[model samples]
Target: MPSQRGSARRRQRGVLLAGIAILLLALVLAAVLASALTRGKKEESLEPLRWQGRGTTRNLREIVLGRCYGYLAERRAELGDKDCLKIWESLKDAFIHKNPCNATTEDYQPLMKLASHPIPCNKSLFWSKTNDLVHLYTKSSRRFLTLEDTFLGYMFDGISWCGDPSAPGINYESCPKWSECEGNPGSVFWKMASKMFAEAACGVVQVMLNGSIETGAFRSSSIFGSVEILNLNPDKVSEVQIWLMHDIGGPQSESCSGYSIKKLKNILEERNFKITCEDNYRPVQLLQCVHNPDHPDCSLCTNSTEAP
Candidate 1:
């Protein structure tokens, strides 16, 4: 009887150990499943940034055919075919199936050809690193027209787009950032567009440049610097006005007489285009003063400066 009881106790011990082992296995499986679920959630969170072109294409069409047409409705007679499907096609073809970072100006030749229009001479305004302020000034006063006012530029302003060579459409989420790729879709379009705008420049043209930047008001590598300035026809562009714009607050680092500005003036003069420089161009100063009347510079924002 003692031996049998000992045997029964041993059996009980074995069963208990087996149960513990099974429980541990279940716990491990639960942990693995939980880890997988967490990973899936993390991946799902990143979906928006990598959004493929299927949805973006539709939005692009809407921007080209919808919003842009409305903006150009008043001038439709001058810019024929409010229908922008062909223009959209040309733009897409320029980068589709091509490397996202390998698009060049020539790649956009077809699109440029389709979107070309005669900008009124002397009304053209170019800007570098001052897109927001320039647009606000132009939109409100309507004194100067910018590339952003054009149908092609208006549609894609502040937007990023690129194509995937492996995919058939735009890779909105993973498109290269500006300065990441020299021949990026956005860069190529702007290069071609700036060239055309500069070539069309007539009479006195205005360029709004930021003075606070360490790179100087005129950066030689900027689209305005490299493309626009080089393309400005000396015969058509009688004068090139440099609006060296500064902020209303303190920390003024650059001026119209800065080394960079002098280089820009020399370039224009060499091209036979009369150069003019205005420190804190009047209209821009007025806008800054309007924004910050309490600023110290606001009180001194008089148009007091020697002519170029």
Candidate 2:
């Protein structure tokens, strides 16, 4: 009987040892699984921001101001903080009214201008050297002026809107100095002359906004930005648009990122001017200029909303 009891005890001890081994193996497996899960989570958290989706490229200013004011919360602290707040508040106080349709400033000039101004387009590439242009931003109200200024300077139908070097009144179109190329519509000489005028007007605006042209610029130099139009209500107003034609060399980009629509927006904001509506320049380059050689020359292309 004693020998039998000893054998049974030994069998029980072996079973206990087996159970311990199984438990240890399970614990090790559990630890390995936890580590793997942790590593995966870390990798996911550390992934870099890749702009993989098909969206346009945005300028730094346009991205910051456009996103910040429109979608994000109002009042970013990065800009001239409290002082900016006060300035914006005062500016908006004169504009925002008990009545949405008839708000105006203390000077009454803005009100008069809004009243007298001809049917305003939804968006326009305005040409001005006026102070009224730059006062659109109001951090206190978190409002940004809208409108994308695609190109600056005076853009008239016949002339490129730059003052002629030969004479103040004469432009690229009718320079007596260029009697050699009169009635030539748009000769090579005329095109170059127009470019010069556009560049000069753009340069002047740039100087006023920034201390140096290299540090900052207008038109061609203005890149990747946004402008929030102030007091320009689409519902109350008429037409609005921006020019996006490929008159210059090289292939015109279908997307805004490849172009400087945002940059134009930013430069205008710096000048205290703002615009509303998209700068209508999509990828499909259409010859909409009245001067197009093709049939159905649509010269009446001024701010009629973007075509999807």
Candidate 3:
């Protein structure tokens, strides 16, 4: 009987040990799944790229007052009122305490009304995907004004903001990526702003397109193509100058005579606007040549004609 009891005890102990092992395995699996889920969420948050310190209202305010206020101060007299406080208030009112994904262009109408101004004739510059190069060139030369150079655009160019219905204010932690919704606040604002900027274009206007794109630089989905180009008034704007930017090295594909560009030209000409195209604008090429002097296309940098 004692031997029988010992064997039974051993069986019970083995079952307990097996149960514990199963529990531990389950825990490990759960942990691995949780970790994978967290990693996926993090990766998904990186969509619709934004600059640093751009997600929160507090950080955005600091940028507006500190960095952008200086830009506003330079033209305060012309700007009138110069109440950046009002601008901030209106901007936040458009998105805060609302659905992050449902924001529309109309949401920002109040801010636009407060910030709207007429851009000088022939000074308006439009670009498609060439954000970095266009901004760099425009900042260095006072010859043109891209949307960001404007008071409102300057204040919020690189910033990102969105709202939560459950939350009292902005959601700086995570917001629906811009591409996740057509009514994304950031994209809607820019599209509306681009429309206004294009509507304001007069005399000779310039468009800088990246020549490296094989599908063609002028995409109808782009802000320039979707909003700006359509809004341009043929009566006010006499000419559209296309600056096709290419890398310093030789694999240049799109040019003034490229099929895609010719389509763009035909569109402009149909609107009764004169079309002009330059292979590589001197200023932009010079910038590339400066950075990459040893490139084969550097010779063409100095030789290329400047935009008239």
Candidate 4:
């Protein structure tokens, strides 16, 4: 009986030892897995930012080349001796293989020079918070030209692009937003373009401001207010005419005599620019009435004695 009891005790000890070995093996496996997961996270964090905004426009090169060729074909007289291939190369070199947020205005100088064309005197139009209406008016009137009408702007008006340090250079997967960084490619390009456009303005220039903007029509931080207005040549640009237009229906929060307009006027006067402000300029209002003919505000010329 004593022998049998001792044998049972020995078996119990063996079973306990086997259980401990299994537990130790499981702990080793868990530690290895945890270490591997940590290493993976560290490597991922070391990779460059992929950016978070809209991806670079699909077929970016094709679109840019197409626009360049189209501009040359349509405006050969204005754009003399421009090499589209050189312009594309300059543009690509501005941001390619670099951090998307590191591109600066100076980097676009070559591209700007390659794509530069003189904006005719008295035809320069600037707009603030009235992008759609301003473009519509320009399209219909064909009297004035905005920055977007030029070759550089025409090529990249709504397109987005950025660069990566990885393969292919250009980040077709994603691009940074203007608000993401001060030196983002898009913001830098537009700033430099706006400055050049304003500097080229000669004789009287027109600015279209949105009267229905609740915060005010003239924002000091806007491209027109900051870059364009500040860069205008006082000697070449004789006058700055403002057309403050409200929406077709109601809520005309601002006007020619409002604080915003007054502020804009003061800025122009300080810069030696002859300023003229008109609320709901008749011509632009007429254009707006084209789409909203049933609106009461569209009855401007209804009582006219003249025949169409």
Return whichever of 3 and 4 wins on lDDT: 4
lDDT tens string, model 3, 37-97? Answer: 9988766653433322235555776776665578766887767776678877888899887
Which pairs of residues collide in candidate 1?
49-173, 50-173
Alpha-carbon error at 198 in model 1, in Å? 0.7
Per-residue CA lDDT of model 2 for 44-99, tens digit only, reads 64442222122112232233233334321332232222232332233233322222
Tell me the number of clashing residue pairs for each predicted model: 2, 31, 0, 0
Name the best candidate (by lDDT).
4
Q: Candidate 1 on 67-168: residue-level lDDT in tens?
A: 566766777887876547777788778877677678987788987777778888779899998887898899878888898887667767666667765444
- Please give the TM-score that candidate 4 achieves against the real structure: 0.83
lDDT of 1 at 18: 100
Between prediction 1 and prediction 3, which has the larger TM-score?
3
TM-score of 3: 0.77
Give candidates' CA RMSD values in order: 9.1, 24.2, 10.3, 6.7
For model 4, give the 10-residue run with minimal summed lDDT.
43-52
Q: Model 4, range 130-238, lDDT digits (tens) per residue? A: 8999999898898999999888889889999888776567787788888888888999999999999999999999999999988999999999988999999998988
Worst 10 residues of 3 by lDDT: 46-55
The local distance difference test score of each candidate is 0.78, 0.31, 0.81, 0.89
- Determine which window of 10 residues in candidate 1 has minimal summed lDDT: 48-57
Question: Model 4 segments beyond 4 Å from truth?
Answer: 1-48, 306-308
Per-model TM-score, in order, reads 0.75, 0.25, 0.77, 0.83
